[model samples]
Target: MQKPGADFEDELENSEGAEELYERMSFTVDKGQEPLRIDKFLINRIEGGTRNKLQQAIEKGHVLVNGKAIKSNHKIKPGDEVLVYSETSPESTEIVPEKMELNFVYEDDDIIVINKPAGMVVHPGSGNYNGTVVNGIAWHLQQQSPELTEVALPRFGLVHRIDKNTSGLLVLAKNEKASIGLAAQFAAHTAHRRYIALVWGDFEDSEGTISGHVGRHQRFRKIMDVYPEGDHGKDAVTHYTVLEKFGYVSLVECRLETGRTHQIRVHMKHIGHPLFNDDTYGGDRIVKGTVFTKYKQFVDNCFAICPRHALHAKTLGFIHPTTKKEMFFNSELPEDIQQVIEKWRRYVSAKGIMTEG
Candidate 1:
């Protein structure tokens, strides 16, 4: 309801970033500082920031306790270290929707499925506005039904999102009933979503499950971490099987039980097999000369063409909200990813290694 982040506005006016103005304070709770909420901890530590600003920081996830972001009322235990970023004061600007092209896969009265391409951001925020998936969807919806007013623009009711760089099948609800139905399926873990990823190692088993509580990474807030079993994090389940083995690389399909942000990438990385070409989760530094060496330049060039995580929503299954019929949809790997897999296969074949089956 309030502006995205008051600190964002503060940053624009101050000219200097939050790092320059705000001093990051770290404190280990002693007997006197026993238990306190995250916001209360910030109020006591940070000097210039107001309570309102503190709340904004908490919401934006800039403030962390014990390496985890917490709500304003989150109770902090002893030994918890709190980190707060400096304030930002940027001016508010009108968000004008720009025209963009959308590849429509399926559309009906209540829902639409799109094969969102890599490099297309899902929404408008953080130095990106035009040319996003949302903008494109908005444009398409407007053109599809001109009788609908600007206020009537459904923007293709976003039910869930794949990362900006991950290309795959994404469904958008056309109305509220469909949106609620699909969202509930995701919440209940009934919608079967599967992804295909080329990771950097040969897993031990033909199939296995990785389950853990998923929370934000301790140092890099953008990345998710597989936390020790606990309450603050939600249970994430990933079932993976190897379709083919390429010595140092393996093509695998992963299915999720809980749809947390970066669930597959985080879980795979936790088990020592980060996605191929993934930089944040440790796929970028994979030994290039191994399988993908001959086409290193080509692969690098392709990565630049679509600088996204090398994961795709290969298959999706759910019951139709209106028809009540079980439905499933799948997309082949994108050209860039397909090439990576092909090259790896060639390398493995050259070495006389057969498919894993």
Candidate 2:
């Protein structure tokens, strides 16, 4: 959501019958407060703001003490200036319909599944103000065929999300009941998800599993790290098997035992075999030599044309939300990724390398 700027005060004053309130706090540590934690002090001083909220504010770099943002758990000394700025929640905007194409895989009264192409955002955001998967679904529902029911625009129930760059089978619910049911399935780790990926490595073993608690890196927001002193992290499990192995590249199938944000990407990176062309996580190894470097230009062009991670959601299965019948859906590889795979195969074959099963 966009942040309110200089006009925030005027807009707040002119808001109809409602006033947004903000409180600024400042403090100086006492003689005995030398060892007090910054967050603790804020909780003690700010009325109605809990330690959790204060910590969130501080970690988000919203808390300034002596004109510097301090860590939530940082110790406070005898003399320190503290400031806190709070704002009202931004007004929610109704998702608008856009004339975008959608590849509908399956649809029922309770749920809908789409073969979401790579580079398509699951929802709307700043850089993507239109042409989102949700926007397409909204538009499609508006032009519902006589075979489908009249569903409301701006109301496709999304249970979870894939990264904007990940192409996959995505499920949406038709109503709140289906949404809640599918959400419960995800929470319970019973929903099945499988992905196909190309990684920059050779694997001696055919299969393996990765299990760990993943959290955002302290220094690099884009990277995830296995945290021993865990914060808002959860245990994630991924089972993978080698499908094919080029001398320097391996095609792998990853099955999620527990889905978390960037689970496959982080787990593969943690295993020292990050996905091919994943610039954010050591993808440089995939384009080292002169031949691969020349090939890399074509790969990069394809990626830009596709504009997404090479990962694809290959399979998804779950029980029907209303009928209780078991359901499953699988998608063939998108043509772009298929072509890349064939090119890699040719490169390996020319070198007399045996492809892995």
In model 2, how large is the Cα lDDT of residue 304?
55
| Cα lDDT tens digits for candidate 2, 176-246 | 56754565455445788889998877877999998887766667654566654255556778899999987
Candidate 1, residues 158-189: lDDT per residue as tens digits? 55667666888888777655755565466556
Which whole-number lDDT from 0 to 100 does residue 321 have in model 2? 71
- Root-mean-square deviation of every model: 10.8, 13.0
lDDT of each: 0.68, 0.68
The worst-scoring run of ten residues by lDDT in candidate 2 lies at 12-21
* Pairs with steric clashes in candidate 2: none
Question: Can you give the TM-score per candidate against the true fold?
Answer: 0.69, 0.69
